[model samples]
Target chain A: MSDANDGAATVHLTLDEVRALAKAGLAKTGLSPDHVDAVAETMVAGERDGCASHGIYRLLVAASSVKTGVVVPDAEPVLDEPSPALVRVDGKGGFAQLPFRLGAPLLVEKAQKYGIAALALNNVVHFAALWPEVEKLASEGVVTLAVTPSHAWVAPAGGTEPVFGTNPIAFGWPRPSGEPFVFDFATSAVARGEIELHRRAGKPVPDDWGYDPQGNPTTVAEDVLKGAMRTFGGHKGSALAAMVELLGGPLIGDMTSLQSIEADGGRGGSPIGGEFIIAVDPAGFVGAMLGEHMKHAEEMFDTITGQGARLPSQRRYEARRKSLTDGVDIPAALMRDIEKLLEEA
Target chain B: MSDANDGAATVHLTLDEVRALAKAGLAKTGLSPDHVDAVAETMVAGERDGCASHGIYRLLVAASSVKTGVVVPDAEPVLDEPSPALVRVDGKGGFAQLPFRLGAPLLVEKAQKYGIAALALNNVVHFAALWPEVEKLASEGVVTLAVTPSHAWVAPAGGTEPVFGTNPIAFGWPRPSGEPFVFDFATSAVARGEIELHRRAGKPVPDDWGYDPQGNPTTVAEDVLKGAMRTFGGHKGSALAAMVELLGGPLIGDMTSLQSIEADGGRGGSPIGGEFIIAVDPAGFVGAMLGEHMKHAEEMFDTITGQGARLPSQRRYEARRKSLTDGVDIPAALMRDIEKLLEEA
Candidate 1:
């Protein structure tokens, strides 16, 4: 939040500095070399894209899981192609990033050959945003929808207790130029970190964000966190959350959010589950007309932006551009937390 | 709507009668024999499932399209397989239902063989709820996601003018027994018909529904119809709507909502475009564990219903059960409208 080098709450750091600090902190937890690199890449990406909660702040959570021995840092992911268009990656209870990295190529190849394909990452300790996954695939000229369930921290619409996760759905579309259009969003009214931030600041959340233990709407962030969080757009958002649970959970042979928590045994570590990512190749569907259709999409974007409306991914792309040149800034408090993780061992 | 067919303004009819009337009315429009049967089935299903808006009321829209030559009543849908797992159905500018019916078997076969498959229906006049499509596939024991863009009537979250369609997204997951878990919803704050109903009744909608011509949020339904409608849940809904546009439009080599409107040339008929449906076979992913995973899904459903949180598709299934026994009701005014359509030449 600050560019000044003075003693401020916000501290400025170059991209390289962010990477080195992230690597150092993760390494302190005995993360495998290649796995650490895969995980650290997502960390740097989060900082570059200004998703601070998903940035180096997650290193503490990773270290906590490491302390619990929940994540298999050196586990080698096993890939299985049960059917022509389906690629399943068994993460062997390790971090998700490496498994996705190892399986994405097969997903791409399948989509190229079959017009559409899906990658299922099972038994992974997931702890990061899904945009990095979709973003990388979109850069490879594929349209994708990626989803995963988290802890059972959210409630279904019209329900009194938690029955679903803050299940996030990320979508990516390859643009003819510039950054490919992308969005990664939790189906909940807001991310869990949002309520946490509100509670940390002693602030009241919006009425729609969550509910009290009785299922009645509440503004107190801490009470709601202890109770249940609502989904965005009411029942429609809840339906999407259910889809994420079904697809990323039982559909792909993995744990549901409830099962994930049950498996954690109250340790409160990162959720160990599965992810479902679907990729589509434009050429396979359109043959030679891909260019003309792509131009039409460009016009659609222009119409949206020309009317003073912002695309969902525009801000992150802007932050990414600026961060590439101007580096990034983090709270001094967060830096202290990272230092604590490094000091633990 | 009333169950009393006496002197009141409502009429009651059995499912059989509903089907007969629907078939007669569609046939009166010179619709092809097979097409009439296929379209009539959806009409009956809509009425049986208590989706009154999508029920026999659509006969009027179908008749209007027939009069305008926008829908080719005799059009025979053509199917082409461009890749191993992609089935493209060209509706030849006919209704979407028939094309989907003609192509569904191929989609199922592909999903069975490849683990995942996609069906893209192009150049069709879609006028029904997507539940029936997903429900059909879900009954066949495959998971499905279907999306289609309609006429441009909704605005992006930050924009004032219409740039996107209602853009419904539907999902279906196979349950262990009984009906599958299914949901189909528009990304808009509410369906376009809701606003139209409010306008006809001279009622004020909620503030969240739409905006005035100047982009100010307005409860006046008429003004919003003339201006722009907002997506649900602010930016998150807008992003999902955009995903629908991209996937149902350019990615499938079909017209965007804007292009569909431009091509409509103010006829105000149904927008002709594409529908994208993805089918995933559970057995391909889970193999022998399918039954075990399915039992887990049942437990998940129990958790949902145990909390008094109704599943998205529960209402329709309930209506279906009741309708099969008692029948459905409609306003006398709607009956007269259908009579007028049938009486036209």
Candidate 2:
């Protein structure tokens, strides 16, 4: 397909079809069949949930990481219990998804036994969105919190230098029925991907989104891409980002964002850092009040939504519902790229 | 003292002098001697750290809450272990400080034993800042996180109704040699105290700080105080505030922000809600590497601050150091009010 024409066209595919295409593209990157399935399934979820930034758009980037030997396609995560309630997983310089998957059962088991459990995954490349992992635990009736660091793309509140990542944190709360209340957000004023999109479209971003190369606040998307992103809520967001770096990095015996960048000689692609996940069983503290507690949460949600305020995951849920019937709309150009990768395999 | 002239004067008091004065004022509120000392010490710390809003300035509010029977001065906190790794405390409708104090030793013990521990405090009126509680745990080489719900003062993003609390969350990370790193901030764009200060000064706040009664964004401090404060970071902060409401409220079988306000019959004072605390031992995960991990964190701090970035709590630490030598500076007007409270007691 001609690039110009392909860019203007969109391809609709069912969830299964997208998963199959993603799996094939991932397998072509020399990942083991099992590993490919795991990663591809997560990518499919990203597409299904309208997280286009984390979906098939990232397939080529994942392949490049594998080609560059940054990620070991066949490495198995090593799990150990540092304490009865702490599960440590060494990702063996591989994808974070597999280790998280390998550690989930133990995390759930320990949480049920001890009322809470923590899983610390180190030496992994965390390239996917965090909600999927926490959502998995929440689906099993466990409340979960997950945090991971990334390359430093954000400046401290008053500093010009990029010293922190657009550090993302995810929280999941189980409900009595239906989907859990889940929210995942980066601490930056705007996600880097959104800025990139704006730059591509020659658009100006909001004034608070980022700074220019000279460290002056700017609305120019191109300038923001060349400079640094601001933290979401100024100093407050910066502090939270710093907290995430500590909890997900050094606290887990992994590299802080600056350390990771320094070790990579300033070369950046996917984040090679640590993932910290904590799971808590509601019954442990509230006892029989768990049901009532969840009901209260549901009522608050209704009250807020009734006031015309949208919840964090509300848009994603709406997109998901639409996608379920209409299928995912993939750019034709990206589809062609994926097909090309499959043919090479 | 005349109101105008006293407001212009600054009274400097030594740490001991401040503690004595605060104790005298708290004792006048009909609290037990032990409770008076406990509450007074926290107030002294706030003054010592230069938190003007939370320090002796709030003494009258605290006293009024006691006098009105909103807080039971002699109520003893009851602590029980819900699980091996969970401690639950019922504050008996008293001060949050006592429950936190009563639960601290057990929380530390359980964290040391199981790698992590969670303390849920309910029915407590949280009158002070959260840092003191977490800082106490961090001093013992435990990383801690604490969150509490308050009366509704912040609005959900995209809505003007006051539905969430300022909902401050505090985090403390233990350092190997020096004092621990700690940060406490409300999820709102600006703290309510700050807005009140702006209103008193007849100054306009930032446009993003709050909304008018008509549900439109406003820079008028008076309008914001009469309406609702906006969450920091837009939707991201709202989500976090909601998370706090869940974890600190229903998850602990305590009143949510709205419920607390309603139960108060719309009479606002200090927050009567729940407090959730989690403590984790680094030795349980990285063992001897804890020192190295802390060193790495220090290096990041150095790099950031060396480039002009100020870490959260940096100013507080500076203030505390200055206070040690020069004493705390209190507004003369506030001192007069505190003296009146003491005399009335």
Candidate 3:
């Protein structure tokens, strides 16, 4: 893989090198080798899929959080698997991906036996993306819905000042074609990471994408960080974000207002990031009849998109296909930045 | 209670009277008395909350559907309860509200026992607003999520022709203030119901809310119906709606594309609808520690919105409160339309 730096410099680093570098950085923060490996894998997957904002870009931030003891590495999830159909975990301030990865197989296994299973994780951190997890489950023929709660960063309609994070929700369903329809997105006008990207690139953002400190639409990335982000669809996006906060922040015992208050008061960090996962078995509903319905649904989808309906995540996959088939193109400057992080370590 | 005629200009009718009229209309279409009453109750609730488009206004269309034999009232929901934690219901062509109402209770019951439950309802119709069901659960101290596949009337980012519906998703959680935080909204720039409202009122819509047949943004509601509805926040809203469609539509066995195709072939009526409901018990996490967290969550909510975070659905509740305290205020012209419907019946 070609490397790039934020300052427009180019360097060369294979994908493995980058992953190893990220893993090494986490180890420096007191994370165990296994846990560090898992985190690195999750972040690398994002980068591979062209989601730079969610991938290596977060390495420094996550490390800083760990260094500040904002997150715990050795924290074992508080498991509450009382039944075959139910599983719950308190992440206990560990890597967000750890609890999910640990719970995915268990939940999927339960679904196979009981037809459905749910695992709720409380007190994790920013899960990179839902598509990856959903994709994993979908590959195994399980339908999944993953929801994560967030903080106050996006404003509601007709008002300004952030009150919720761009809580993202994702879903995956399998088709007879052995392909999965995966959909994932943040419930905000735009994700904060996107803005951070623009800031790093020193580029102007779309006017309606964010707001200034006075709550006016702005093109400057810096202003949005100081103020609030706009919701995707005025009231609609705002409503969804609130839902995430309730689920990820409050309902699941993740970040509470008290936690934020404590964080703000310079007390030890405590934004218990929470996640909810649902897995389903087709046998519960249509059973063998599912194939028939899926075929019909496909025909219907084909008819509607006669010209072409862009299936969710198809674009990203296509991009990935192109990248792999041709070459994993990287911004020269970004590669340099990766090298810098490694050398600094 | 007062009765009115369609041609009798502005008039007032008690909520019960309106519901009765709707029930009578449904009865004329051969729906079972129980089913008609259930559907009528949903419409009345929408009207009481000032959601006029989803209220009595929809009765005409629904009755037409039943009269045309598009909706089968006697169809029973195919319940597939694989475990206490999950349920999958096939509406089998019944009224949309039937499965929604039934599913909510079942999911809530399961959640009450196991701390979490999920229900997926397939082959239904427009479920109206999701708040009532969520509020019902929330009032009982449970958190709920309700999502439904939508009609294909909205376009994804940078695309034209309605390939998606103004899919609405709702989330509800209880607050100690005797108020539940209930959020219901469409994933489009504006709700299809809102566009219908503007068209019925002979008013123009806002630019960017929808597009004309030529794929150009227009303020004309008629144009939106002919063209497409815009997704909120560009690609982000489109992505979210796509997720809803996959989970609530195809995965659940309702496909909008097929609905349009069947409609064209005169083999079906309005699109079949699908919905997913999830309920989670807070005690599943912190156990007895949940009470303290709830308090903290509410406080944090208050602190954020106390400064400026507008809680979702707050305005709707405020409007409903005002209407109840001051008496349901019916606009002069709308009152006439209701009277006309009664007379026509």
Candidate 4:
């Protein structure tokens, strides 16, 4: 490993090396070999794509979840097609990736046949970044929208108490001839993990990011972690968060954000919630006009980028390209923590 | 009319009186009887629900569009089912309500059979609020998501140029045994019409609402009208606006936001854009669990509202209920404008 210095020490490791380390660390948690590989692949992509919070930083949590029996290491998801265009997957208390991996092919097939399809996952633990799932579908030429709810950490616009999750939503649009455009974001002003990272670094957040424990706006990250995160865009972002809570929770027969938190008793592991994924095929509706459609989209992109505007995923794509050649840089402390886990295993 | 004095002259009129005025005012625009009725119903609902920007304030523009040969007053939309779960409508240059009125029933029917359905409208001039379309579907126990793109009025987060539309999106969810929950909002920090209203009233807007012509944030509404509106949640809202642009424009073989502006030669009328609506039946997947699903959602609403957090559309519903009894309050100046149009007819 090579060390890259900014203010803190960071270690650069090849993608394959990181994947091997993740797999080795997770395998000892009693996960099946296939489960271990799936989790490792997801975390590797997270690191490669520059989402450090969701990358190797989460491996220890996964291991602890397995050891605490919160996540069943060898559980299998059951897939059912309730309708021609609707799929339901019961994750059976397993990692979210397992269900998505089991059901994505079927979702693509249905979308190809029916023009659109919806997949709902229940009783799943979503621990990875959401973009990988939608981006994978987009790679197969499918436009996808995915959403999931976590523990309640965000407050409504005018209220002080937490009633919603960070509630991330992801969208994927496939280009006619190249990589898909993907964007995933938490509806809150800032992701909870980012605040935690700020707190760990002993830094203050922006005033708009969250409220303190007394329900007053505060810049202290530690204060915000003890209080609640504010939704982005005031009332509008709050509405979107509520939409995710409804779609991912009640609509899917799973736990709402508050329910998830209460049930888990804040064990600091992945929450047992639901995920909703919808896939649509452009060719299904546009048919021969698909090229024209894509051309128009490209024109919009060109006009915007020509004026120096960046698309949501443009920076991530650039980071990924550089990582492919220069390797992924992980925080030196986190690298040490993973190594300790590996040694123990 | 009873005048309510508050800085400006406002008049209270019964819902029936407002609908009658809207129907009479729209009838002179060369629209067919059915088209006029549909437009009137949508406008009346907008006023009754307290969205004054989308209510009587827009009648003059709608009539002008029809008179200038931009909107085809009598044209009929043609509905086509490209797939079992997809319904396509060609608006044939008509008012937007025509297409929804013609295709919504089909969308509902198909959603009943297929568990999910999508309606794509092309060449439509959308001049009314979007909630009506989705609210109608929710009334029939169908969950609906609707989106439409207007002319370029919003700038990308980090860019100065206007490349995206205000691009409103609406979502509706039906309760098991009551009125549905619905919300509609523009991706921009504030709707363009509201800014124009503020300009008319000679009031300054919040600095975050928009930018001046020099790409600097400004509170002057007139400068914002000359410049561009900012997205609500910065990059997140900008990404959503882009999503609506793609889904409603290129994906449906229609014009992009800037393309619509150029096509109209900046006539300041409603643009011929596309609309996308998706409907899903909860019972199709959850079956008997639908009630349980709704119970969880109600609990969330209760807990949030109990803590004084208002859900989206809660105020709208309350306003509508009061309007049904105490009548709708409209600005006297707007009422006079409508009466003048009616008198000319």
Could you give the TM-score of chain B for each candidate, in order? 0.96, 0.94, 0.85, 0.93
Candidate 4 local lDDT, B1-345, one digit each (tens): 111112377888899988888888888767888888888888888878877766766678788888888898888878898878889999898888878988998888877777777899889998887888888889988888899889988898888778888899999989754668888899988878778778877999999887788989999999999898988888999989998998888777788898888888967878788998888877767888999888888887777788788878788888888889999778878778778887784
DockQ-based class of model 2? medium
Output the lDDT of residue A55, model 4.
76
Q: Could you report the DockQ of all the candidates, in the order they appear?
A: 0.86, 0.78, 0.41, 0.73
The alpha-carbon deviation from the true structure for residue A177 of candidate 3, after best TM-score superposition, in angstroms, is 5.8
How many clashes does each candidate structure show, in the order listed? 0, 0, 19, 0
C-alpha DockQ for predicted model 3: 0.41
Candidate 1 wrong stretches, greater than 4 Å:
A1-7, B1-7
TM-score computed on alpha carbons, candidate 1: 0.96
Residue A54's lDDT within candidate 4 is 68
Residue by residue across B227-274, what tens digits does model 2's lDDT show?
889998888999999999988988778888888888888566678989
Q: Looking at model 1 chain B, which ten-residue stretch has the lowest summed lDDT?
A: B1-10
- Give the per-residue lDDT digits (tens) of candidate 3, residues B1-345: 111112335446577666776787667667777678778888777767777666676676776677777788777777767555677777888877777666767787777676667788777755467777777778877887777765677786757777776777788888877678888777788766667767877899998787899978888889998788888777777776766666565555556533543453543356666777777776665567788778767865675577665677676687667655554544566555445655664
Compose the digit string of candidate 1's lDDT tens values, residues B274-322.
9999999988889999999987778888888998889999999999999
Instruction: Candidate 1: give its CA RMSD in angstroms.
Output: 2.3
Clashing pairs in 1: none
DockQ head-to-head 1 vs 2, winner: 1
Error of 1 at B239 (Å): 0.2
Per-prediction TM-score to the true structure, in the order listed: 0.96, 0.95, 0.86, 0.95
Listed for every candidate in order, the interface RMSD values in angstroms are: 0.8, 1.0, 3.2, 1.2
